[model samples]
Every structure is written in C-alpha cells, then in structure tokens.
Target: MSKPAAVAQAAAPAAPAFDVARVRADFPILSRQIHGKPLVYLDSAASSQRPLPVLRAVEHYETALHANVHRGVHSLSQWATEAYEHAREIVRRFLNARSTREIVFVRGTTEAINLVANSWGRDRLSAGDEILITHLEHHANIVPWQMVCAATGARLRAAPVRPNGELDLEAFRALLHPRTRLVAVAHVSNALGTILPVQEIVRLAHARGVPVLLDGAQAIAHEAVDVQALDCDFYAFSGHKVYAPTGIGVLYGRESLLDAMPPWQGGGDMILSVGIDSSTYNELPWKFEAGTPNISGAVGLGAALEYVEALGRRAIGAHEHSLLEVATERLAALPRLRLVGTAPAKAAVISFTIDGVHPHDIGTILDSEGVAIRTGHHCAMPIMELYGLAATARASFACYNSLEDIDRLLEGLRKVRELFA
Candidate 1:
C-alpha cells in the first residue's frame, strides 16, 4: 500500500492519469467496513487518508533514522535534515513555488496565517488602514485578521458574496481604497464549494499595491496551485488535508515578502546570535520555522506529495469533477434540499441543507448509517449567516472515493427524509 517512495524519488513511471481502480489501491484504510457497510470516505476536504508510501515513509524514518533535525552534527541529523528539506522540495514542486526557501513548515494552515498576521500584519498595519477579506473565509482566516485589527487599529472589511455563493467582485472593488494594506481570502471555501477567482483577485490586489494572502487549506489539494502563476503573495495549506500527517503544513510566501516579515516567535534555531540587548535571525524560512521542526511529519508530507505528483493533478481533478457532478445531481434532485454554494465552478465539496433538519441532525443520522460527512458552518460563519442558515451538511470526495459512495450518501439522505416525513 505504500507509495513507491524510492521510485517517486526517481523518474515517474509512465502511468495513465485518473486510474481510480489503481489509485484506490494506495490508500489502505479504504477497504474497511463500518456498521456492517463498507466505508466510503467522502470527507477529503477535511482530511485525506494517507497512501501506503506515505505511511511507510513515516515508519521508515521513525524506525531507522529518528532524530532531531538541523542541530546535531551526527549522521542521523544529516539523514533527517535531508529528508525534511527534501520534503520541502516536494511541497515546493507540488505548489510550483519558486524555491524551497519560500516554503516554511508550520503546524498547519492556522499557524501559517498567524505567522503572517502577527509578524507581517502587526508590523505593517497602522491605524485606519484597511484589511480586506471575504465572507467565505474559514474562521482561521477571519479570527487572525480580527486580532491584527485590534492590535494595530486597522479595520477589517468583508467582501460580500452573492446568494449563489459567488464573490461579489464589485463589492470587493468598492471596498478597496488607498489605505488597504493587505487582502486575505480563501482560494476555495471550506463550507461552500465555491472556487474564488483568486488569480483575478490577486491581479486586482497587486494593481492596488496590496499583497494578498490566500487561505489555501481547501484549494491546494483540490486544484493545482502555482504560487508564481497566481502571483498571490502568500499561500498556506495543511499537509493533513493533502493525505499527509497532522502538525505539518506549509507557508509559500513570495521571497521578498518573506524576507521582510520578522519571526513571530523567538526560539532555538530561528536565532543566530543572542546578546543581552538584541539578537540576529536566520535566513529566509528557517527564521520563521523557529524550533525543532516536524522532521518525520515533513518526510511523510513529502511522500504524500510524491503520490499526488505521480497520480497527476489533471487526472485527479477530472475524476473528482465527475464524482462531484454525479453527487450534485443526485442531491439536488431531492425535495426540501437546498445547495448552499452553486458557483459556476467548484471543487469536490457539496454543501446543502434539508428542510426541517438541522445539519447536525442530518450528519448524526448519516454517521449512524456509516456515512461520514461534515456539518456546521464549517468555521466560515459569515457566509452561513448570508445563506440564512446556521450550518449545512458537506459531503466532499477524494481521489480514492467511488461513485458507490455517493449512492450510499443519497440513500442515507432518503432515509432521513423518510423519518422526517
């Protein structure tokens, strides 16, 4: 079940893209049963199951080469450090970032955002300066800005979206002014499936001389992200969401921007020389990393990324699109069912509310039926309020999921409807 990690390190095999039958073989847990029914993991938007290669890589490191990275002058440190840095290269390639130096590993997306807000936002923001974000942001994107505003006397404005869950570009344009310092937004919404026009948004933001930080937690895995192409100043995502381990994520920042931001935390490896009065910092990414980084986690992340790269993003996306289309059609056919996000384009996420059923109630029933899905505002409350609901049930698909999983989800929905009726 492990990814051909050694093979992945070498040239990729000439494999057909979008081979779901073969792709399913990599994820070991996809074969399990729950509640007398086969497990159908339709929640990759929250977290993806690890492939055999990724699992094996993690085990290989822990068993043979487990050690603290970046400090020891020993052979184990060199091995672990190489693994960790190689993992960064894998991530850099995954995002098409310019350099591995631009990829700073943090615990996950939340820490990545805080690094920017506290380190960059705090230093740059001033009283009456405006920070723009969208209604579709996850709470991680929202709360950090709120703190920045409170600390610096800057103002936070939410760019409104339409009822169809599309961003109101006009509303966003109107909010932009001379004082706008930073524009933070989600590349793809977690609760709703709307894919924001981040490239266009970035273009606009850059035109105004404002830098944009994209909350790429949901978007990075579902779509091919090119930080250089999108020209987003910063793009952040969690490895756990991309079939890697928890406590590992990346912050892909523009080299110049990263060079300017100070370290949010003052600790071990982040510093060069410390004196009674002052201290100097390390270069580029290490300055921000600050502590003994997640070596094994990073190695696992690299392996997961290798699996993804070998699988081919274009084919993976096409397969996901088919699954999403089928699920959307099936769910939309139900009476009393209202989809929360109906953008012209979306990732593998589908959010909806059934009349007279709280999303949590629906989720509970589905879980009992051995179906897993997400419920609640999905940590993006402003858009939930905009839709006039407290929460929605979200069924997300990953590469390993089959059409049969969607059918099971539909069956569970019908049963819920019957109970209500």
Candidate 2:
C-alpha cells in the first residue's frame, strides 16, 4: 500500500512520539519464550511478525468475505470486492500515488521485479542496452534484471559500493551513459541496513533519460514512502517484510508507463474479452494482476498499513534509530567482534561477525539463548564477496523490538565468544 507524502522522509514530524512498550503490547509473539528464555526476535528484515490487528483482519475477511471478486453480483462477492479494492486505495494513499490504477499486487518484491522485467524490459530493452544496479542489491533485485538482459542481449552493469557498504555515487553516475536504459537500486540494503541515496539516484537516472525502479522491501516497514516525491518509475515491496502475511506485495508504477506496458501474464481476470481471433486486456491494474488475486492477503496488508500509520511513521523511524545506535555501540564494544555496514544513515539492522566463530555458530548459540537472528550471505552474495566474507550474523529490528532485545543479543554474543575462546 502507498503512504501520504508528508511522512516519506527522515525529517517528517515526530509528533505523538513513539511509545515502544505500548507498541510491543500489540504484538503477542513478543511474549513467547525460547529455550526457557524470553524471545528476542531480531529477524524482521527477513519477515516481520504480525500484530493482532493484521491477524484479525485476515481472519475476518476469510471468515465472512471469502469469495472471488470483480465478477460476481452476490453479497459475499460484493463484500470481498470492496475489501480488495479498498486495499488498493490504502496502498495508493500509503505511497501517495495519484490513483489506485498504479498499484499492482504481486506475490512479493521478487515477483514485482520479475513483472517489470518481463513486461517493461521485454518491451523496451534491446541489444547493447544497459541496466545498472548496485553491488549491495539483494539477489531478488539482481537476478530478474540479469535474466531480462540476457534474454534481450542487454548488458548488466553494477555500480561500485564503497568499503563502508555505501554506494559509490560518483561511480554510479559515471556508469549512466547513452546505452543505459534502466537504473534499479534498493532503497535500503537488506544485508547492511544502509539507506541508499535514492533521491539523487532518481535525479541522475532521469537526467540520463533512464527510468528508475526502487526495491523497497526493506524500507516500507521502517519508514514512509511517496512515489511522487521520489519520482521513480516503479517501486516494489513485500507485505511480509512489513508485518503482513507472505504471498502478497505491491508494485507501484507510473500510470503512463503501466498503461503502455503489456500484461506479463494473461488469464481470466486480466482480460476484457477473449476471442478465438484476438483478445482485449483489462485496464491498468487488473491487466497486470491476471488471475484470482490474494484477497485475504490484501485485506491484511491494508490493515497492516493502517496500523503503521496510526503509530506514526516519523516516531517509528526515531525509535528504530535509537535501537540501532545502542545496538551498534554495544556490539562494537565487544572483544574480537567486527561490525559490518557502518553507514551513517541506516535502518535498524546490524550484521556482524565474531573473530574466531563462524556466523552460523554464532546464530546457533544466540538461538539457544532465545535471541533469534539471521545468518548467511542474506541473498547478497555479491556484497558478501566484496566484503571478503562468507556470512554475517544479522540482527534486524522492527517496531516491536527494544533496547532489551539488543541486551539479550549482546549477552548471547558473549556466550558465542566464550564458546569460541
């Protein structure tokens, strides 16, 4: 779903300041214990846990309004249709899009990116054309463009990233030349939590006549996004990453661009009329949506967005920033521990490694202590190789996380270090 333009940036108003304890109460999973210890969940970058509101929303829709939408005239169908379409409006409002037509629902960010590659890339890209991405991109953002480029004989170029895990903007700008057709980048690095200079990236790409697509899976839960303000051609994100269920996501495209692009997949809901000779596709969003969509998932996603909005985006940002600061400092103070991705501006994620322990081992010990964290290349092997590492222990935060969570993480890390020692 889309957001209001007002809360899209770092400097948005922080009124009704975030209340962490109050917010934590809304998420029931936080109360669960692991290994006889209170659960310290810090894997939100992979998937955020759902709150009561989202869960209830999904349950309500499935229980009462479980019917196929847009084709039926019965009461149940009409109710289902309203819930689904209202979800579209929620997305449009969440992203500050001009209309609901620009918001196309897909399975998740991966599918959204693939949709653009298959539809837009296939239609517009040709031999010798170039698609530029960054070294810090998640594989979801990288592989689809690679497949599209390989199919079209278009070249793929990766913009350099600095030693500190920040994008080399100078190198990125230099790579945009006559042959560059698309510039795709992540708004927030999933591996490092580094927020990219997307506004500048958009401006530079547009100056070079290249359209931009932002992978915002890691950005949406932590901050507000306005498609118009960024002026990006497309923005994609996953519902699970933002506290909704899996198998639901959004792709926001400029109305003109989407209108001109052909449907990536053809099915019943996407066609206006089908004939033995020829077929006419449905309008903007449904044309892209294709089949019977994820009705309940959309309803849950709408409720999730509303939940975030009521909490205040600016306040959430501030709260998470504080957690990151504390977590970074405490982790840095640990003996023989190295922190990765120390960008000045970041979301609430920390990837690190202990001197004598494998990241997997670290994750294992942490889990034993009821401190859940992620460990791997994080689907960002390119960035991992760039850092000359195999993997890192990643602790990513959400609205439900707290300073005490970081404390448990640190305590768990100390155990890992002691074990290795």
Candidate 3:
C-alpha cells in the first residue's frame, strides 16, 4: 500500500563507476524495515520497485510539460510530444529494435500480446493453420494465441519442456511444420526462471518461414534483449517488470509485419481520416496505439531503461546471478527440499518446494517474516502439471536484491517448517 518516493526528484546518473550498493540506495522501499527488521524484497518477477530516476522522470513530465501528445498546437504540446516520442526511440535503443517505428506502447506485456494476436493473427491466420507455443508460456502469451486460434478455427499446440523445466528443443523442432504459422514462447519463464533457447528457436521458426512472438516480460530487466539479433517478429515486455509504472508496456515488431497487420482498434490517435461510412488507418506504431496514450508512462519507462543502461547490463546481471547462486545453494542444502526448474541457465527466480508444505503456506510464512516471495502456480499451471506438482515457492531477484535477502527467505522457510512440525 505504501508507494515509494512520492516526492519528485531529478534523475541521477548511475554513479560514475556504479556500485551495486550505491544503486540500491535509489530504491527507498529497499531501505525500510519490515516485520521489525529490514525488508528483503525477492519478487521482482511480480513487479520491480521504481528507482528514483524513473520516478523523477515521470514527475518532471507531469509537472513541467503536461499535455496530450501529437494533437495540440501549443508550445507545451510540442514539448510533451517530443518527450513522448523520445521515449519510443529510447525503447528502440534499449531493445535494439530495428527502428523507432517498430516500438508500440500499450498497457503492458499482456496488452501487447493481445494486440498482436487479435490484429495480426486475425488477419493472417486461416482455419488449417496452427500456432505453436510452449508449456513454459505465461497466460499472456498462451491465452491471446488461443483466442486467435479459436476464432479462426486454427489449432494450438504446446512445445513440451523436459522434467528439468527446460524447453525440449528437439520436441519444439518436431512441432515446426508448414502449418505452424507462428511460434510464441517466453524469453524467460516467469515461474522457472529458464532463460529459454530463444535464438535457436527463432532460427528454427525462421527456417520454416514462421514468425515468432517472444514474451520478454521476465527477460527485459535481467538479460540483453536484441530484437534484431534474435530476429523475432515480435517482442513484448511490461514496464512494471523493469522499475516503471504498472500501465506501460512495449510491443516491438518488424516494420513489414506491422504495416501488413490492420489496426487493432479504431480511435482518435490510431486513424488517418474518419468518415461516416469508413475510416482510414494511421501508420505503423500509431495504428497500434489508439485513444489518448500513456505518454507519462512511456517517459517513466524510458527513464527506467536509462537507469538500467547507466547501471551497466553486465554488472546487474552478475549481481543478480551471484545472489541466485547463493539462494540456490542455501535452499538446496535444506533437507527434504526439492528445487524445481533446475535449467542450467536461469535468471534470478528460485522455485522450490519443501517436503510436505504447500507453496501457498510457504508464501504466507515468508510474507509474515517480511520476506516477499511468490507462491502457487505462478500463472504457468500447465508447466506445473507437466512437473507433477500443483505449484512452487518462488523467490525471484532483481538488481535491488542482496545476498541477505536470500538468507531471509531461507530463514522464513525454516520458520514454516518449524510451525508445521
């Protein structure tokens, strides 16, 4: 309920040489005490806390240059519009998008995927075609494609994962055929933290002339996402996952693909000309964004991206990786504890189950100890079913997380075991 840093401040560059300790200071929530002790946040996969720079960027835009973008003739409108459009270029650079026109802002990853599936899928898919997704998919990626498949009388099939929670590339290879119109998969698993073999998947899909939509909701913050290098037709991510506001997200698509797909919705900003009988659609980016857009959110997200870029990608990745290694070793040392999703390459997520306790109970006990972690299916239930489990206790990390946070989670686990005993 407590929003961090309500006061507006100027954006700060990540200290010249950037120290992890120094970076953590930007997050006020991280410094607060919880349960009479320091709070240990381990749920970045759910949503990350906004850094001071990102918060200030949003505040500055709202206070100094507040106006609707691309519609007004006043000076404030020009300033606001430039700032809004600048956010797109920022995202384009952040994601290594081929062009700024490829970046489409929406509510979040969920809406981004929905927009593509409904707009592109509806226009391109036919009854005999099929969409190939993996069991590792979150509901956002899985559901939208399913809706498209159902509407078009197309079929949906899941590429299975091995028991270790890694996608079976061999199985995924077999699923690729002429009818496989699209391959939708997560760049990183939300529950398992599996950094998927996306490039290989993309190469395979591209060989078959099939497009790929990558759900980068988890990967954007932790790993380097290069749409040009990955050659994915679409990449979607949420701002909240990257220390930005809840309602902002990005959909990066190839210029040709975007131009080919019709507008998802018809409204003020998404059209060229409107008439009683018919309406003409706008170009690439704008065609996807209808109505008054989340211009403030875009600025905040760009700031979040800038903050991360300044932090140095390698440093953040190394810091979180070290924390995950510590958490993994500590949790694995516990008797009767089973670690789920042991993919060789993983992000900061650590999902494990104690011998007899339910994941829900574990989550409750952890929260009581002021150590936050996600429990239950983690929105990938089919993946759970594949592993012969209903759910897992997940402790996901972010740049703000420290080694002590992992210890708190371990302490919380011990408490849960003690109470049940």
Candidate 4:
C-alpha cells in the first residue's frame, strides 16, 4: 500500500458494533471513583490496567504453584516450570515464532534490548562500525545502542523525523550504509504514536546484511505482530503496556542469531554445568534468561494475550482509532490547543499542548476532574528536542475505553481552560 493509504487505513475505524460497554465490564478498575468523579484513564501507554483474567491467573499461580523452575523435581517445581514454559509457548505462538527457544523472557523491554546490545552488538560491532536509528525511537532503543557504540568505537546515527512525526523514509534509506551494523527503531512511537514503516525498514537493512530490532512496547498491545512476516531479527515488548503485570516481557530473536550470541547474564537455570576452571551455558533462550524467572508474571502475560485474542486485536484497533479521530477533531477545534505528532498512521495516542498552559498544569487540573493522562517528555527526550518541546500531555487509549471516556476527557480539558482563563 502507498504510505498515505496505509496511514488512512491505520486511522480507519473498525466495526461500529464493537460492544465497548461489554468490554469495559471485564475490567474491575474502570468503575472506581477518583476525586468524587468517575475515573477516566487515558494512560495505557505508560502502563495498562490489568484485567480480571490476568489478575486471576497470577493469583492462581501464587496460591497453588509457587516454586522455582527448571531445577527441582518436586511437584510444585515441576508445575511452576510447566506454567513458565507454557507461557513461553504462548508467546512463541503470539509472535508466530518457530519455537520456544527463540522466546527469551526478561524483566521488560529495557532488559530485552540490553541483552541484544551486550550479547549481539558487543560481540559483532567493531571500531568504525555504524549503528543506525531514527529520531522517533524511545530512549530504551537509543541509549543501549549509544552505550554499545561508545564502548566499541562505533558511531551512532539517527535518521530525521518529519514535522508531522512520520519518519523520513528517504533519509532512513540513505542512512543504511555498508558499515551500518544494526537498525534499531520503535514499531510505534510512544510519544508521537507514529506507526513506523518497519517492513520496508527490515527489507532495507537486510538488503545490506544488517539486522533490525523493533522496540514493540507500544505496538504489541494494539496490533497483531507476526515476527516471521516482518522478518526482523529481534522484537522486544513489555507486558505492562499490554494489560499484563509489570517487570515481565519477551524478546523474540531469530534462532540462528540467538544461537550465535553469548549469554547476557549468568546464574542458575542459565548454566548447564559449573566448574572451578570452566563452565558451560544452557541452550538457546535459557542462556540469556539467568536467575529465577518471573513465573507468575509470565502466567499473567499469557492470560493477558489470551484476553486480547478473545476480544480481537483488529476490533480493539478500530475502536481506538474511532476514539483517536473524535479526540483529534474535538481537540483541534478548541482554541489554543495544538496537537503534536499528527502522523497519518498512528496508534490511539494523542499528545497535545495548550498555548499558555504547561503540560504538568494540564495534567494536574485534569486529575482534579478525575481524568488521568500522562504529562511529560514520555522518555523520548530526543523526540521532544526534535520538536522543540519541553513536554506534551498525552492521552492514550485501550480496548476498555469508550466514547463516554473521551467525553469525560473533553469535559476535563474544558475545566482546564476554565481554570486557566
């Protein structure tokens, strides 16, 4: 599809009969009151609220099967190991990966990226090599590469972002030079909600024998990610962004690449044997997943993915796009409120600023009216620098949100205007 067409399709709404009320009923927290008013949560991009199924799954694991995995032959240990490994299989299926060996569990997206940088980048990157990225990247994507580059005498280069928040495709293509060792980028910008052209990026990078890593923290919750179809070397995402518990995430690496990379951490379960003179590491993913794994968190993540699957990702995307469109049109019509990151193809995140009001003030005022939104640079300081912005107030949506929630947001923003005026 043409870029514009793709953008339009991304912004397009799904079926109108998406029973959002029914979906809202699944989440227990949506009914709570904040400051004597109904809570209007618009901060899913930071961390999504967990659904009942995810909570129940974690509770069940903790109550019935709490034990360390992969070592003990006891029943609880075996059960916990089964649950943990089963979660790995679910993640493998979610990403359409070849096997569970390609799925490595970590604390979250940050640790996953660090694993690749330390294990893969440090091993292969030499002096004068280049690591190419985009200005649309979150700090998690940029800092790891910068650290690796600084250590290896490699240079870090970032492609420019258009004023509309879209990545500069031509500049990105040009930046993929012969010495470009890796291409790391956000699948969707958390700050701008820009949906990057990752397929083309992967193709371009692979054409020049460079591997690509997609930070899927923002994209995974809203879309169906088939790593094989994208053909990217590495895909990382955090669980908290997807209605799962925090401190749990997955790294889907191509088996060949993962096999060649050394262990990123050393501890129990990651080692096959230990000797005073020399030690041997475990195979495939276990080599990278050192220490005791987050068993209950993995269970919760599996349940969360199952919940998303049951609701249908496409349906959720359409519902969110509708919210985005309505919010954009309404916010744009208001005086002195300017929308930032008006990318054509975007996830359901809206970042904006008022002419005279600081984003923190906006957030604080909105909070008084029981509306919760993120206000800050959103950990994308480079993107903020690119736009000459200190911060923007961001309202991000998820499946449980509804048109009523958007109305609440508008009402809260009006209160902000009234207070400022």
Per-candidate TM vs. native? 0.95, 0.96, 0.95, 0.96
| lDDT tens per residue, model 4, 1-421 | 0010011123335545477776776778989999999999999999999888888889999999989999899999999999999989989988999999999999899999999999999989999899999997889999999899989999999999999999999999998898999999999999999999999999999989999999999999997799999999999999999989999999999999999999988888899999988789999889998899999999999988888877777878887998899999999999999999998999999999999999999999989889999999999999999889989999999988888888999998998899898
Ranking by lDDT: 2, 4, 3, 1
State the lDDT at 222 in candidate 2.
87
Poorly placed runs, candidate 1 (over 4 Å) = 1-17
Reference-based lDDT, residue 263, model 3: 87
lDDT of 4: 0.91
Worst 10 residues of 1 by lDDT: 3-12
Off by over 4 Å in 4: 1-15
- C-alpha positional error of residue 351 in candidate 2 after TM-score superposition, expressed in Å: 0.8
lDDT of 1 at 73: 96
**Candidate 4's TM-score:** 0.96
How would you encode candidate 3's per-residue C-alpha lDDT over 7-126 as one tens digit per residue?
A: 222246532222556667888788887777778888899999988888888889999998988888998999999999999999999999878889999999999999989988998889
Q: Write the residue-wise lDDT of candidate 1 on 130-239 in tens digits.
A: 99999889999999999999999999999999888899999998888899999999999998888999998998999999999999999877798998889999999999
Question: In model 2, which runs have C-alpha deviations exceeding 4 angstroms?
Answer: 1-17
lDDT (10s digit) by residue, model 2, range 245-307: 999999999999999999999888999999999899999899999889999999989999998
In the predicted model 2, the residue pairs found to clash are: 1-91, 2-91, 2-93, 2-94, 2-95, 3-94, 3-95
Q: Residue 49 CA error for candidate 1 (Å)?
A: 1.3
So what's the TM-score on candidate 1? 0.95
Each model's RMSD to truth, in Å? 3.4, 3.7, 4.5, 5.1
